[model samples]
Target: MKNSIFFTALLATTISLASCHNSNAKPVISNEIASIEKTSVDGNTKIQVALLLDTSNSMDGLIEQAKSRLWNIVNTLTTLKYNGKTPDIEISLYEYGNDGLSAEANYIRQVTPLTTDLDLISEKLFTLRTNGGSEYCGAVIQDATKQLSWGKDNDNMKLIYVCGNEAFNQGGINYKEAISDALKNDIYVNTIFCGNQQDGINSYWKDGADYGKGKYFNIDSNRAIHYIVTPYDVQITTCNERINNTYINYGSHGYEKKQKQAEQDRNAGSVSSANYAERTVSKSKAAYKNDSWDLVDKMKDDEKAIDKLKKEELPEELKNKSKEEIKVFVAKKSKEREAIQKEISELAKKRQDYIDTEAKKTKTQDDLGNAISTSIVSLAKVKGYSVEK
Candidate 1:
C-alpha cells in the first residue's frame, strides 16, 4: 500500500505516489474526473484540499504525524454539514525537497492530484521519507496552482496547506507572487510552519497566509502524537475485517485494488492498533467510496454501471456470470458492506466519546493533525459549513 527511499514497492494507482516532474509537464490525473461525474449526477459539490508537505531530512516527524492521523482527518470531513448536506472531499498531496526532486525547479514534486480515494491518500503518506534537501515555499505553491484543477466555480472550499520548516522566501520564486496566484484562483494557502510561531512569522510564513486569506499555524514537529485506546477499538477492527468481505471485485484493477485495501489496513495496524481502528472507522464512512475500481462502488455511483462496462472489460470472475447474475451479486455485496459500515459507524461514535473524555486530561501540543483540524473547522464555519451532531 506504500514508501521510498525507506524501501521500494510499485503501485498502479497514481493518487499520491511520490515522484518529481516539472510543472510545465503534463499534469497528473487521479480521481477528480470520477468525482466530477458523481457531482454532476448528484449535485454534490466537493471541498478540495491540497496538502503540500516538505519531506526534507528534519521534517520526518511531520510525515509520521500525517501517516497516523490522515484517517482521523477524513472522519473530520464527514461531520461537515454544508447547506443541509455534507460536501464531498477531495485531497491532493505534494512533497517538496531536493532529496528526490528537481533542483532547478526548486525541489518540488506534485506527488498526487486531487482524489477522493482516502486509501490512496493513506498509502502515499506512508511512502514519504525525509532526506537532506532544500525547501522552496514559493515554487511549490506555484506548481499546485498551475498543475491542479482548482475548478472554475468558487462554490467549493478550495484550500492549500503547505507545511515546512524553512524560510518561506527561499529560492528564486517570490512567495508573494505565489500567494498572489493562489488568491487569484480563490485558493486559500494556509502555511503550517513546523517550528516556533515567532520563527514562522520571522520567515514570512504568516505573510504568505495573509496574502491568500487563510489560517497560519506553527507546530512543534518533534512532539509525539498520542491516541487514547478505547474499549471500542477491538470491536471496530473486527467490523473492519467484515467490511472488506463485502467488496465485489469486477474490473481489471479490482483484485489489485482489493489487495491494496487489505495492505493499507495492515500498514495502519503496523503503525498502531489504534491507528488501524481509526482507519477502519474511516473506511465505513460515505467518503471511502472507490467507484473507479470496485464494482459495488461503481454501481453505487451509477445504476447503469453494469451496462456501461463491456463484457470483455469485466474481471475473470464476472466473465462467466450473466449480466443479471453480476448485478445481483454486486447488489448483495453492497448490502453487506452497508451493514458492516453501519456497525463500525456506531462503534466509532462510542470510541470518539471515550477519546474525547480522555482528551481532557492531556495537555495540548502543536502537531499536524491538530493544526489541520483547528483550521478546517474554523474556515468551514466561516464558509457556511456546519458540523453535524
Candidate 2:
C-alpha cells in the first residue's frame, strides 16, 4: 500500500461549493496584489510544479478538488528530501477555458508564476471561477512551459499537471509539440482526465501523458472528497492561531498582507477541520517562507534588513523605536515563531501516525490530491530522493 494515497487525503479535501460554478461571480481575493514582487529562495535542488486546470462551466468540480487538496499536496511534497537536503518547492497555477479570460490569449490566464509563497497560492486557488469556454490543452501547456521560470539545475524535479474533461487535441497547437517542448526542459507532463479511464484514453489523454513520459489518471471530478478526523486535530489547529500571532508585519502593505494570512487560515478551515490542520502543518515547514513582508522571516535572508527599512515602512509598533529596540522586538517574535513551529511539527508527526494506522482499515480512492501526492513521492524516489520517515 502507498503511504500517501490514504494518509494524505485525510489531510486533503474543500471549498465554498455554492459559488464555485457561478460564471459571473467575481474573485473573492483582491486583484491589487500586482505590486508585490514574486520572490524565491536559492537552493541547490528544487521541485517545480505547474497546475493547468480547466475552468469551463462543466469542470467546476475539478476546481473545487484542487482547492480542497492544495495543502495536502504541499505537505506531501515537503516530506521529500534529496540527499538529506530539503529542496525549495514552488507551485504555479494556470486557469484555462474560462469565458471571463481573454479569447486572444486562448482563454488561458497565468494566475501566478512559480513561487514558494504558499499564502499567495491559496489566495489564487480560492479565486478560480468556472465559466463556459474552450479548453486548449496544448496552448496552456506550451505557455506554462515557456512562461514560468523553471530551474536549470539537473537535479531539479519539474512537473506539469493538466486536468480537464475536453478532448486532448482540441486546439490549433499540437499537444505533441507542446509536450515535446516541456520534455526538452526536463519537465514531465501528467494528465488527469475528469471522467472514465477508457473515455480518457479514447480522448487521447493517455497518449499525452505517454508522450511526456508521465503518469495518466482518470477521476470522477463530481464526487465529494472524504477526510479522516484525528484526535490531534484540535491541538494542531489551536497552535495555528498561536503561530499567526508571532508574525511581525512590515513594509507598506504589511498590515494587509498579514490580514490576508489570517483570511487564508479561515479559508482552509472552511473546507474542513482536517484541511485546516494540514495547512497549519505546511505553515510550520520551510516552504511557507514569507520574507517579502513578515519581518521575522525577512530577517533570516538578510540580518541587516532592519537597517535598510525606511521610517515609514516600519509598522506602527516599531515606528518610534530605536534600531536596537526594533531588533530586540523582531528577535523576540522570531524566537516565539520558532518555538510554535516546533510544537506544530511534532504534533503533525503524531497526527500522521494516527492517520496511517486508521487508514489501513479502509480502501483508498483516487482524487486530485491522491493522484498528485502518490506520483510526487514515487517520482521523487526515482530522482534519488527519499521520504524523511
Candidate 3:
C-alpha cells in the first residue's frame, strides 16, 4: 500500500510539471497581423504675426511691394509644413504715420485684425495706402500691447515685423518698455530697416529686435524696389536657361542678351514720372490732416455716449423679465455692450497712447538713429565682428 501511494504522488507531480511547461510554450500560428497605426502629435498649433508697417509718405513703394508679395509669402509659409501638417496662421496689420507730431496719428489703423483667412489679409493690404507723419516705435509697441490679443496659447508663436525707413526710439515710450512688454508676451519683433544710408538708427532698431528675440534685416530701398518688380526665382531661371543655351543660340553673345534681359527685368516698373504723379495724387486725396481732427472729436463724442449708456435706466423689457430669462438676456447684452465699449476704449487709447508715447519725447531723429546704430554695432562686436560706423 505504501509503494502504490508513493507511485500515485509521483504521477500527480509529473502531470503538474507538464501542465506548467505547456502554458509557458510559445504560440506557433501561421496567421499574419497587420498594423495600420499612424503616429502624430496632438493639438493644432498656429503662428500669430503682426505686421507693423511704416505708412509715412516715403514707404509708398514698400507698401505696394508688400501687398503684391503677400500671396507669395503665404505660399512659402504653406510649403513649410510643421510636423507633417500645415500650421494655422493669423496676421494683423498696423500702419504708423497718420498721427501728427509722431504722437496723435502714429497708428493710422489696424487694417486687418488677427485672423486665419489669408484672403482677408490680402484685401486689407490692398486697401492700405501710405499717408502718415512718421514712424513711432514706442507708440506701435504700446498699441500692440493694448490692442492685440496675444498670449492666448503657449504653443502659438507670436511675431511682429516692423518695417520702416525712420529711426526707432523717437517716440514717448522708451525702447526698454517696448522690449520688456514684447519679451513678457513671448512676441518676437523683427525690424526691417529700409534706408539709403547706414546710420546709428539701424543699431537701435536691431537692439530692440534682439531684446524682443527677433531678427533684423537691413534692406536698401533701391534694391528692395528692384526685388519687388522682379521675382528672385525668375531671375535665377532666366540666368540658368541662358547659360545652357549659350553654345547653340548666340554663342558667347547669347550671354550678353541674357544679362541685358535680367537687368531690364530687375529695373522694370521703377518709380517713374507717371508712378510718382499717381502716388502724389493718391496722397493728396488720402490726406488725413482735416479728417484726423474730426476723428478726435468723434472719439470724444463716443466716450460721452458710453458714459450716458452706463448711467441710463434699464429698458422696461429687460427689467420685467423672469429671473432665468433675465440672467441669459443680461449675459448676452453685457457681452455685446462690452465689445462695443472695448472697441471705443481701444480707439481712444490708441490715439492718446500715440500722442503720449511719441509726441512728448525729447529725442531727436538723428539722436535716436545714432543710438540704434551703436546698439547694432555693439551686438555685432559681441558676435565677433567689426561694424564700421
Candidate 4:
C-alpha cells in the first residue's frame, strides 16, 4: 500500500502542434453588467486545477518530475479552444506528509492558492522539501474542495489531482466524503497512485478514482524526467529574453517579480537547456499572464486600469510621463509583446512536431507528466474544448 500510494520509477526516454487561437485574441466583457458584478462576467472560459501532492520522505522524485514537466503541461493546455475562444487557466498547489509541516493541521500545507501566474507555480514547485510523515489523502482532498473558489459554470473544467503513497483509507476523514463534496462542487478528482498499477488497484486507488468520477493513474515516481531537445529551442529561448524586456514593472513587487521572472528562467535553465526553452514556449501562450505586476498584463485585464494608477506609482520609465504618454508607451509594449509571443507560438508548433516525431521512435516512461496530460485531454474533451493542431 505504501509503495502504491507513492511514485515508483525506472528511467527511460521522452503533444501535436497546436496554435493558440490568434495571439491577438482579447477577453470581451458583456455590455449589460449589473453594478454588483463585473469582474465575473468576462467572456473567457476557465480551467481550474488543484494539485495535491504527498511530500513525505520518499516522494522527492515526484516533486522533481513536477518541476521538470510543468511547461509541457502548459504547452498542451494552450491549445484548448471552444467556439474559437480560449479559456483562462488557474492552478493551486498543496503539499502533505512532510514532518516540517504543522502537526495539528495533519501535516498538510496549501503551498499556493489558485493563480494564473504559471511562473509562481514553477517557483513554488522548486521550493518544496520532503520530510518523513503521514500522508492524509482524504483530509487534504476535502480541504482543497472547501477552500478554493471553484467555478460554478457547468462548462468550465474543475479538477483535483491528489497523489500520495499510502493506503487510501489511512486518514481519519473518509475518502468517500471528500469525493461527495467534490461532486457537489462539480469538480473531478483524479488519483495518481505513485507505485505499481497492480498494487494501486489492490489498495483501492482505482476505486477512489471511480467514486470521484476522475481518471486513475498508477505512475512510477522514481523515473528520471527527460526533456526532448528540439531544433527550435535556441530561437524560442532567445525570443523569451526579448519578450522579458517588454514588461513595464509597476507597484511594489513589480520590479521584484520582473527579476523573479528572470530568476525562474535561470532556474529552468539549471534543470536542462531544453527544459528552460520549453518554459519559454509556455510563456508565449495566451494563458501566461501577469496582470498583478506587469503594466502590459494589467492593461490587458482592464483597459481602464491605467486610470486607477497614480502617476507616482508608475515605474521609473513611465513615472514622468503624462497619462496619454504612458498609455501610448504601454500600447507599444503590448503590441511588441504580442508579436514576440506570436513568434514563440509559431516556433512552439515546430518544437511540438519534433517531439512527436522523437516520441514515436522511443516510448517515454508513463510518469506524472503523461498521467496529468492524459487526464487533461480526456476532461477537456468532456468540456467541449477542441484542439487545433
lDDT of 1 by residue, 189-291 (tens): 8999999899999999999998889989998887778878899999999888788888776666667778989989999998798999989988887788878
Which candidate tops lDDT?
2
Per-residue alpha-carbon lDDT of candidate 4 for residues 148-169, written as tens digits (9 for 90 to 100): 6677778788989988767777
**Model 1 — TM-score against the truth?**
0.89
Model 2 gets an lDDT of 0.83
Q: After superposing candidate 3, which stretches have Cα over 4 Å from the reference?
A: 1-43, 99-105, 200-203, 222-389
Higher-TM-score candidate of 1 and 2: 2
**Structural similarity to truth (TM-score) of each candidate:** 0.89, 0.90, 0.46, 0.88
Backbone clashes in model 4, listed as residue pairs: 5-164, 5-165, 6-165, 6-194, 7-194, 7-221, 8-220, 8-221
Name the lDDT of candidate 3: 0.44
lDDT of 4 at 142: 77
- The Cα error of candidate 3 at residue 152, in Å, is 3.0
Candidate 1 wrong stretches, greater than 4 Å:
1-43, 310-312, 315-317
What range of 10 consecutive residues in model 4 has the weakest lDDT sum?
9-18
Candidate 2 lDDT over residue span 42-151, tens digit each: 65699999999988777768888898999999999999998899999988888877666666667677777787888888988887767778888998888888767899
Clash pairs, model 1 backbone: 3-127, 57-131
TM-score of 4: 0.88
Error of 3 at 98 (Å): 2.4
